[model samples]
Target: MLKLLYNKKASAALANLSVGGRLPHAILFEGPQGCGKKLAADIAAQYALCEGEQKPCGVCSQCVKVERHTHPDLRYFTVPAGKKEFPIDLVRQLRQEAYIAPNEGCCKVYVIDQAHAMNASAQNALLKIIEEPPAHARFILLCENRSMMLPTILSRVTAIELELPTVEQCAQALASLRPQNSPEERQAAASGAGGNIGRALSLLETGKPARAMADAKKLCELLIFADRYQPLEILAGYDKDREGLLAMLPLLKGMFAQIAVSHYAKTGRDERVCNRVTPAQALDAAQAVEAAVRQAGQNVNIPLLCALMVERAKQALH
Candidate 1:
């Protein structure tokens, strides 16, 4: 069984198949970063390789092997670190290996991370095996978004979308994962990460992301309630911190996005910003933040970039 606190829809869909004992030959788990796609893929692989009567009884040897990544029949693949995309050569090799018999069991489970990073050629090569997979083979693809996948590949697999949990749920989850941390610390991390478990964990491990998010939220509040000069004070703080600026820009953009749609939807902590800023102004601010992110990546002068971002955000209010 898949043990997950959030993404109930995805868990249920995969759980239903575990009961039939005939899982999909190819399945894709799609969600944003920190949304538990990898965890779901591992659970699905366990379900395929388990020998227990109830399917993926997690205490069984087969399940333990999968957890330890020592199972001979379970294969894992991902793009080489520092590389932009999966090479066609690796995909061809994977396709060839899909036909080989399982080493330790009747079923072979292959879990591929960052499947969306495969280029057209690599995706086409992968399409061959998924199109006509061996009877004993099962493939699990993990990606942030399904839109990056080729249409042909998308048609061949079952795609499950994993949703992020709410802030309270994320805080509750952190209690179990990081028992040493105080409840207040966990709640702060969860709020800073906007309910992303992976991001919250990263924030807890290193205070940088949490610091960036805190500054970003303060800037948003200033932009909404105070004069333009007050926000510049916050922006100038990031002038010498490139990494912090890079981290904070996306969060600022995301907050603006939430503000833009808050009139029609629920946006949790951004309700104050939504009430103060109109949807049009919020959207323009989001675009300005996006431009600042691009400029930061291009080696722009950090101080000049920060000043320009503040100016643009001020203009967005008009």
Candidate 2:
């Protein structure tokens, strides 16, 4: 029921439970950013709250209200902008609200985003309610790292971990989400994001991320084949664009990762994960990029660093 492009396992598991009318009262959706955990939580909440026979039939008023976030029965808790952690004060308030009767829907859905931001006391306050939640209440916790939660709290919920999609899968997802983008554009965004479709979407939706990714991809191709000066010329545009320069580093590292994966694939080891680049020198290139990222953080001279990075990459690739 989640409209996300990937993470089929989590989707299927949740769907099965909803259809069987056996969905858990408390759930945890955990993964790195852009892995679609939040969206999964939304869909699960809708499915659980829907009153229709088919359950979460999007046409039903209950489902529509949940989608629009106008449902009185569905509430959320997240850390405020300036707060360093999810405070116990708010958790206590949530606990008190949890027992109240739903105003409209068959059940009440409670969504907690960035659940990892809850400190020890805050999670403890939350554990009390989830340990013995009201029969009409469902809790969904969205977390960046599952380990951040207290063991006791984690045990009380059904946890689902989301995985990153492959580049081709990401490209297809992006194609569906952004029909205006060319396949090549979607593929570039997918590659630049390290196969995170959410990140790819952000790259396409925001011109800055897309521009930085374009520069990184161009520099990657030039590093592999261009003359030394040509590559240096490419780096010059990033002279004052610190954000762009930083964004390019991960992508440059990813290109080396692709080469390493491609090498294993050629040996028939990891055929499921494919990459276009083949290199006898992937390790060297990867190390050079790592060093550049490290040095960039230490206030090095910009122009000197840029030229040196190009030279190091050129030598490593050659």
Candidate 3:
């Protein structure tokens, strides 16, 4: 499985567990959204079920069943569609299911994606089972942040933080997935994706490398100008492509940070591309941009927020 591509730290952790036979009953995989935490959990589950010394023997029945999601002992839990929280009912059902002995594998694996989305009551219900899980049951709690979870929950399980793969690794993996693409195209997509493999594949599939790069360049230019007209243009463009705008937030933020640091180094004082301003001024501009980003996440009118951000940027520049 692609889990073999896990970063060195995560791979070493798993290897240590396998060799020492000291795998925890519950493991929390915390990382950025597309960093392959779920894949690693699945690999660990397969290892737990493998009949041979090496795990995830693709030919083995257990491995096949786990991959197919038909394994009686392997249970998967995720937030319901369109819902922001994991319902207590799901936790109760899982509690009942956990008691059942493994049907076809040596261990029963339960994978909870977005575990932080569980409400307080749901978390409490889960805490009970986690504190005293069945001998054959194993839990994988996948979260983007540990702070979102209860302190009690955080204390029980082992935590594994997944880091984004290197650009070369991301490019190689993307190439393997899209063998039809030219090497240059694959490389461009990988670099544009900014270490996100899923995004890299999406960009490749949709042939959006040129558009993404163009958008990034334009955004940088707008920041450099720090003018009134450009913010309106950016806002209009963002309104026309909300998804793309949202996807580019982190990239824009990174660029601004780089500009801030470079300006500081060059001038011996904090300045960003937006203006020859103090560090605090640049930070204010960044924060304003971040607020606009948060508004976009709330489904606010992108154009309106963009306009507001542009006005703020103009003020900061002056």
Candidate 4:
């Protein structure tokens, strides 16, 4: 099952909560993109709406409906296509609908995808309902980074973080899911995506590395060379593409992490990033990239954010 394999910690926690009947009114599944936040949310929804005693028996009618996304009591929401932020109008509509009782089950589950993309206004609008949610209502928020969320919203939600699997694990999964592909192909895709299963599968399907990963790799090269002009030039390409910028952040973070690890481990390090910076500089740059990633979800101006990220990264290196 998607819940059991990739993230044991998250799986155990969600299972315990559902079995103990101690699920909170709101839950936030925070993780990098393609790290199974949506899958975890689906599992949580099943646990809440499942009619079986074991909670999400997977064979029960409610569980099947939830799996098929046919459960009336389970509602899914995301930023509308082509829209940059979660609009306030949608939040207002959802708030009005939240007052209604569940249609088929004892409780209602609302799965909000990209919760981090919610602007300050949308978050405030959502807080009103979450703060005093109806007895039968439940919320499961999916976010890439929790720092973009309002403190009040974060305070009310139970947060669950999911970790990426190893390249070997991801490759094994791909073998089962994409058996037509050779083992060599699977491993290559897995390594390219840094163990993100969703991204690896996408790589397999397209036979092309994602643009975000390419851009991130380029940025890593520029940072390693301590080039000033090229970093700004690359970042300017993302000024109008926040989603692309968001996708790139985790890749950048992962590369920096490798750089930091390489400094201490002295072997099995990425060739492109090895010996580029001092150990302290690599660690500091990793933190800098991480902070930039967290800040990306804050609805900040993309150009300004790119500038700040470049500045901090350079400062950490030099």
Give the alpha-carbon lDDT of every model: 0.83, 0.78, 0.74, 0.82
Task: Tell how far residue 20 is off in model 4, in angstroms.
Answer: 2.8
**Candidate 2: C-alpha RMSD after superposition:** 7.6
Output the TM-score of candidate 3.
Answer: 0.65
Q: List candidate 2 stretches off by more than 4 Å.
A: 209-227, 238-318
lDDT digits (tens) for residues 1-318 of candidate 3: 435574779877876776744368998989887788877788777767777657556658887777677788888999999999988999999999999998878889999999989988999999999999999999999998899999999999988889887656887987777888766556656655656787777877776554555565576567556567864675576577665665455445545555666664755543334355555665666776677767776788877888887777667645
lDDT of 2 by residue, 99-144 (tens): 9999988788999989999999899999999999999999999999
Q: lDDT: which is higher, 3 or 4?
A: 4
Candidate 3 segments exceeding 4 Å error = 20-22, 56-58, 210-318
TM-score of each: 0.67, 0.72, 0.65, 0.64
Q: How does candidate 2 fare on TM-score?
A: 0.72
Output the better candidate (1/4) by lDDT. 1
Distance from true location, Cα of 269 in model 1, Å = 27
All candidates: CA RMSD (Å):
8.7, 7.6, 8.9, 9.9
| Best-matching candidate per TM-score | 2
